[model samples]
Target: MNFSFLSPVANAVLSHNELLSMQALGRKLRIHSVEEGIPDLTGVSVALIGVLENRNSVDYIGEEYDLNEVRKAFYALYPGSWNVTIADLGDIEKGESVEDTYFALKTTVSILIEKKIIPIIIGGSQDLTYPIYRAYDNVMPMVNIVNVDAKFDLGDSAKPIKNNSFIGKIILDEPYNLFNYAAIGYQTYFNSQEEIDLMERLYFEAYRLGEVSNDITIVEPVMRDANIVSVDLGVLKASEVSLKQRLSPNGLDGKEICAVSRYAGISNKVSAFGIFDYKPSYDDEMTEMLLAQMIWYFIEGFNYRVKDDDFVTGNNHQKYITLAESHELVFYKSIKTGRWWIEIPFLANVNNKLKKHTLLPCTHKDYLDACNNQIPDRWYKAFQKNSVY
Candidate 1:
């Protein structure tokens, strides 16, 4: 069904020129003109999606960057990045009860996955992941998901599906457990002590703010394992994000945020990458520009991954890759149980079947681990020099 996209709403959203210019700089995909518009994503590979407008949800950023802007910007620059598409949340509002919206988004995201189109989700709240995750979780038994945020989003919030609790909800409600979960750059206040306890008990993978380094020691593996990646604007430091429904005083800075964004884009598992909590009510061009830059870097990384990450078949199992370029290969597979994953790694120099017939050294004494477990990357430690997350 075609939802009514009001003119006022359209005005609030970023104009095509703003996004197309970004495309011109990268110039991956070209459309007729900003006004003439882009193709209908006939053969797109990556999907940019978001709940553009919502009332009960936080509106600090307002709806300036709706799902359409996300779609236009990415497609303009990265043509065929998204074949399947859905614009806006269809009159969804925060205070209004709209469980149906969640279900619809879930179905749409699933469709994108089945089509092999990586999803880029820009959001109204962290809860937006509910439908996106539901869609992804249904088709893929095991998927690696990463959240770069300042809070755990433990499902205890003012609203059932507010930005904060959505990830918590997905983890608790999924039919089969996720492959692995990493919550990065969390602030102490957004979460309760009890929630932190639960996170520790669950052994969810995590990296405190200080733990992140340019070398990418903590985050690379998270990207390595994930089939899809997610980012919440709240994860970024206040200086980095001018607009946020709920702002964080302390978190990841601009450079770190950009690095993580690139890592997610490049990894390629990125069936769907979602960014939430950018409230335009507080946005300045500087912050929007930062957001725009982050988006560009992410698309560039995705371009590298998609152009490069071809799958490999093994005797035991077929391997699917996320980011298999720039010297290292990363892919994930499920073990006997639906809950766990086994990562098969190789130097990019090797062929796709590197894990199939060849033997590689286990970088970590314990190769298989839970989210919180830290496994040293031998490739990085011994060869790459500086470690990267």
Candidate 2:
């Protein structure tokens, strides 16, 4: 609980919060302030932490940024009927060295995870995800990350890590804790053919921007199995964001991005969530309001989470067996939620990441595909990865 690296929320935001209605989210938060120091985290289910480190951004020009506007927009909103307690632990100022900032973030996130509290990180650059990933080293034997971005971000591992390529470092670095990585809303033109091939060869998942926009529900099962979820603001289309924050002309709109965030929050297995690569503008109310609503939807989704993964009791789920070619696919449907899961058979002899039979989240469509002798792409890739591991 050594959060000495964190600075208090800006006084300007506090002044703004004081004038808001009593039902505003700012009024309900356990805020860390100069007067009160860090808030007591007791009964806190979610902690908000902001990072001011953007040196690793590919377009870095020594510019500084703050989340004060985003906080103001967030605080002015009314909270849902959420039962979860939220705390704003404030921002981590840019350290003398980028590594110093990374160390502070890794330590803070690790401490929060140990207490079973989810951290909703707002960061200056997406590369900060590297430290968040590292924070999971001792907490879990294996980790699955879902990155909602327009690029693969598998930059050259041989070079210094940048926001666009930190995934390369994550894949090549030590501990080898990453079990699965999925990219949602990735644009083909933004990535090289080699990166695309690498994703397929490694059995990693990638969904095209058009594909996700066409059907947002496809993200649910992927998010359902993820341990950490990271979103890059660059995924928003040019028209949806401010001039400074725009990255692509073709990207997710406001409604789609919020849906994605809600999916991340609803995932029972997701422990850490972050939205990165924010650039503040003079009149950035549109982007700030959108980001605030995204956070709101995420919190709203978290409040409705139900544990449907427990298959110990046969009465809770209905089991179905289907044959696809020579493969026998076992499916489970939660009686309570109607959600589907496919079983990945255990191979006792292989030295694999999964030591026991595991359930992979799937859709009702995947079940129908199995009945039609068509194997789901998700099941095939997961099975392939498991076999190779």
Candidate 3:
């Protein structure tokens, strides 16, 4: 209830009451206004926060941006059959400096996480993800990040932070809370050969845009293991969005993007979700509606969340073991949902930060591959990362 760092939404954005006649989501939203102060979040499940700081956006340069239009679009949507409480805490106006804004975000999000509320962020630039990640410092020691974007955004950390290069800062900064970073739908051309090599050398995961476009479901396992998911609007094909600055000719379509959002919501481990790099459009209904639907699907998925992280009881899951050449691979499948996970053995005498969780979410194909005497790349990479701890 003490959201001291936030500013309430402007009355103009909620002035339109036409949505009331249609049973839309606008009616159900506990919107922050000048009269009511902050919404009581006692039992709120999801809280929406808008970051109006774009000074770090590498593409926006010196221009100013706003999320009022996107807010209007999102608030006009119809809520599906869901029981989860949602509130819009309004925008975080740009601070005197970019770092000032980061501090505000870090404090606000950290408090919400302590209250067990998932924060969905709409941002001025993708760089806001850094603060969102930082907010988890006191909540959890280490976390896995899944980015749905076209570029690696690993710009040189030696220089000041920009939206495109903030990841470099995250990976090298102190406290080193990042356990794993995964990039989904990265365009090879956008990333240099050296960056690709760096991904391999660091044991991080990156799936090319083509791979996921062909089979969108491949993203399920990756998202399932993530604690934070950051999405850049620039990853959408130019046809789907109206960003004049960066016109990506090819990327994930609206449907694929929504499915990705749903997968992030379905993951029990995912605590924070953000959509960034939104270019202020004049009157683009397509882009607005698409973003609204994405939010809708995420909430729908959250409403259907199941308790499946427990693997010791052996009551709701079936376990399978396979020998690839030298090491033994163990897999678990949920009897209720048919979802799969593979176990990565912990190193002896090593204290890992991954407390009480060693089973990595995987696919049925990984089990089939193990049965054929092949080592699943996911298991191998995870094992290698864990060994370093």
Candidate 4:
């Protein structure tokens, strides 16, 4: 478990931690400090790493920043009744080249996932997600990403990867591990019509900002089915964040964004989680506090996770079959957690990507829609993608 790429947490934050209450989160964390180096990770469930590379941002102007404010705000909070152990693994300093930074991030995230430790990344730009996604190349057969963002970020893959266009690289790059990508809280106005049509043509999922803000629970099933969850702070409404960090006036509020993070945390399949595009400011207290709370909710949800995916037990779930149009919709409801999943039948031929029958997480509304002879959009897209791949 060599973490040579990591730089220790600043001494100032460590000094500040000593003045806090003994019950504060700062006292509870296994921190990487200048004196002790990286902390022992034994029995640690979650590791936090900050990336200080923003050179790839489309609007880069050679600015430098740090995550100390976020750390200080997070550390001062009191932890909930949680049994999970967390370690702050410090930050990955900007490398000589953006590619070098990406390599560092990819290696770090890969190592964390190999040890079954979820890495909660706080980054300068969302493009860091590309390296994180690449980290899963040999770890999983297929990957699903859920981005809590305002834009589709499907920039031209033919061009150099930037924060706004990294997804294009993910889709066109080697190994081709990306199975499904979903954008939650996307504002149509922020994305071009071509990008919206591209999302449809590729069978990827995109939920509008208004739709998600009206009902945040709609994101649970999407998050449940995801392997990587990347969040853009720009998804927050302008009033909810600092002036420098604000992007849109009509975006997710603090409560809604925090709820989304919790949903991502509660997902059994989600292994990597990241929050990106944080812009430091003189009056960043509000943004820092909100970011801290968002991380707290994620940990809180992680603590409450339940393993209810085993449908073979038969006794733990109830199966229902309904005929909608020409499709036979199979639904499974977990008795333990009351969660629902819709089965995606495996296509007989044509090089199936899933290789076997798979279950797609769905909401109760999907089941009711099937009963009324309507196909769930999620099921339809998944079925179409599975058939094609």
Candidate 5:
């Protein structure tokens, strides 16, 4: 469970497939230093990840990579016209390995949050979802998670490892509990009977993909409660789409898949977002365009508002409180680059969270490290967030 997503030795070329250079992705993300240029909080933030099409560390030799254009097309999702916030995770530029790229992504999210921006992550692999959850919850409370996909991903049959089982590993290893978690459009074919039983035991709400593709209402409640979303593109069917690996035949169509993602983004609670499972190696160039289309839909949904990005609502109305011994609030410095930081608590009460914990560090890595020293392990355990997908 404590293992890294990729081997230290990349071992081959596909090791770098969808794993794009940071400058290439940064051009697509269009990053602006917040201290220098800032966007008005009239909307939400979108963060896309230009990840490798595969996650098991495959070594594809003769792979064709013309589909790199998909990243640019995907980046177009959050132009200012969308009236939404944008943060792209691919800001780290080229690296030699997946772990290097992973660290870069972890760093990018911290930068985005430092700028008061929420991000929607386009994924590298469904595996990358772990870091997103790890970093998102450190600074804010009232984090509601929603996953829209074909599989339950609740594999507990074996001991946790680098290659499989996200939900089991997240809950048992990083040790975060699911908080008001829900899911939509899951396929029965993807799960074992025992997995379904465990999901019910964990109190997750799930909908069948066949049922979701046909009825829009199936997703309403899940979206309504979610503060963040992590979408797996393989949840869609294999009709004109290409470049997808391990694509199951029993999921929703491309349009329905986009609709589901759009619904979650438009939800008033959604903050940080993630979308993974793009295998351009096996997919057609047109599939990248399809992926771009989904990203735009997410942007379209993110701009709708209930009140304002700076304010808190319903379930998470409590003000941020400094841990007993801490004079200045310490925070998650950033993502897995494994750095630490310090800030005087935020003083803006208009947003209770901002006012109480103003000068906190950026990512959850910072939060866990600081709290482990001051807060009780039980308290962190008590506030855990477990996901359905």
Candidate 6:
């Protein structure tokens, strides 16, 4: 209800009605405007919110940029066979200070999640990911972030937060809600040896671009385990997003990245999603269309979400318990969707944020490895993190 920080979409753009075709999402989406107030989100499944605070973006340019083109491209696309309702809540105008923008974003995102509405954020800079993480501080104490980028973005936390160094701020900041952080499509050349070493020392996960591009399905389990997914467009290859000023030559291609977005949407646990580092270019139809398709895939995947959160339903999942190296590993497979999860046991004497039986999304291969007397690395890392919390 506190949308005072928001600016509605431009009327001239909406008047075009490119999204008014039958079965298109634009026909169903409730658009906010100066003439009409915010939409009634009673049955809405996802809310699209745009932010216009790229001042903190390192090496910022193009002072006047908005999600207009992205919206136009997205609205023109037809919706899948989905029963989900979506709303475009318009853009959050840049505040007096960058911190003010963070405040507005955090408040807006947190309120949406409280209403069980997943917010799809189109952001100004990747640093906004910090506020997106903060939005879940009170709602879910233990947070896991999956970032799709070519760089680790783990700049020195001692310095001011920028688009490149915000992750460091999240890890070193107070409240310490972050339980695990995973960087997918990270190019080794882009990150320092020390940063990569730090990731291992802290039990944080990082997947090289090669590892995922080799097999995109491998990332489904990782995304399935995540709560907040932040994607930086800098990870895309130059050919995928030709208009970007500093596009990388070697990175995930358009199809691979869209697959990652779909995986994030399909996750039952993933609550907040963001695509950042988008700098709209003049007459760049490819960039706009690609971004729109990425969003469309995410929404399409969300419609296929399964109820695998509660294994106690008894009839919904098949439970498997395996003991290896004096440790008990429990795995569950959904009878309906065939998705898998591995349970990490909690310390009986310790008071932790995790429950007695905490399930982490995993692969069928993990269960096979456990049966072969080999412990899956994922279960080990998750168990270790849960123990500390």
Q: Please provide, for model 3 over 1-389, each residue's C-alpha lDDT reduced to its tens digit, 9 standing for 90 to 100.
A: 45777999887777873445467777788888899989888789998998989998766667676777777787777777888999999989899999999999999999888988999998889999999999998888888999999999888889999999988999999889998899999999999888888889888999999999999989999988898999998888888876563458899999999999999988888889998887776767777777777777788878888888687797989999999988899999999889999999978677888665589999999999999999998898889988887
lDDT per residue for candidate 6 within 2-40, as digits (tens), equals 878778988755875543776666776898888898988
Model 4 ranges off by over 4 Å: none
For candidate 4, write residues 1-389 as lDDT tens digits.
77999999999899999999999999999999999988999999999999999998977887878999999999999999999999999999999998999999999999999999999999999999999999999898899999999999998989999999999999999999999999999999999999999999999999999899788899999999999999999899999988898788899999999899999999998999999999877568999999999999899889999999987678999999999998999999999999999999887786756874389999999999999999999999999998789
Can you tell me which runs of candidate 5 are displaced by over 4 Å?
A: 1-44, 57-67, 75-81, 85-103, 157-164, 174-177, 243-246, 308-389
Clashing pairs in 3: 155-165
Stretches of candidate 2 exceeding 4 Å from the true structure: none
Q: Which ten residues in a row are the worst by lDDT in model 3? A: 16-25
lDDT of each: 0.54, 0.93, 0.86, 0.93, 0.52, 0.87
**Over the full model, what C-alpha lDDT does candidate 3 score relative to the true structure?**
0.86
| TM-score of model 2 (CA atoms) | 0.99
lDDT of 1 by residue, 322-341 (tens): 33224334333333211112
Give the C-alpha miss distance for residue 211 in model 2, angstroms. 0.9
Model 4 score (lDDT): 0.93
Listed in order, each prediction's TM-score against the native is 0.66, 0.99, 0.97, 0.99, 0.62, 0.96
Candidate 1: regions farther than 4 A off = 1-38, 53-96, 157-159, 213-215, 243-246, 306-389
- In candidate 3, position 266 carries an lDDT of 88
lDDT of 2 at 75: 96
